[model samples]
Target: MPYSPEDKKRAVMRLRRIKGQAAALERAVEEGTDCKSLLQQIAALRGAANGLMAEVLDSHLRELFGSAKETVAVREARDPDEEIEALMKTLRTYLK
Candidate 1:
């Protein structure tokens, strides 16, 4: 399902924050900031990215399984449990 207006707004806000973080990181590098501070900024950026990914992924999974228009044959052809397991594994790897 497509994002609701509020969801879109929130996602856009998050993306803007990520962009700001990226800009700050770039500025820090150009300014020759300390290694520890740069590493912290990098970690913060990664965490923000991961949070956004998880939010979108959750919405996608909900839409895939919760749609009323999904055909019986289509649903039967794909196992929700298996799909979820695979998604979980992928997420775990990505988070790491």
Candidate 2:
């Protein structure tokens, strides 16, 4: 489930920030910045990327199942084991 134009714009803005942070990290390395400080920045960038991924996943789940609580209802109607297996397959395919 791709976002609307407005949502895409917002996500792009976040990605731009992450890009800038990455550039800063590069500059810091060239300038001999402390390893600990660079590591912290890298960790923060990873967190930001994870947050963006979470948003994407949440959006996809909502599009598929309507909402967070509604997902439980959908899952309940389906066989739990089968659903888990199907989800794993889907994840594997998506990752590839």
CA lDDT, every model vs. true structure:
0.85, 0.75
Q: Model 1: which ten-residue window has the lowest total lDDT? A: 59-68
lDDT of 2 at 29: 93
Instruction: For candidate 1, write residues 1-96 as lDDT tens digits.
Output: 238888788788889999999999999999999999999999999999988887887787776676768789988998889888877886787667
Candidate 2 residue runs with Cα over 4 Å from true position: 67-86, 89-96
Using lDDT as the measure, the top candidate is 1
Give the least accurate 10-residue stretch of model 2, judged by summed lDDT: 60-69
RMSD of each: 3.7, 4.5
* Per-candidate total of colliding backbone pairs: 0, 0
- Write the residue-wise lDDT of candidate 2 on 2-93 in tens digits: 57887687778878988988999899999999999999989988887877776676666555555555656676786667655766786677
Please give the TM-score that candidate 1 achieves against the real structure.
Answer: 0.72
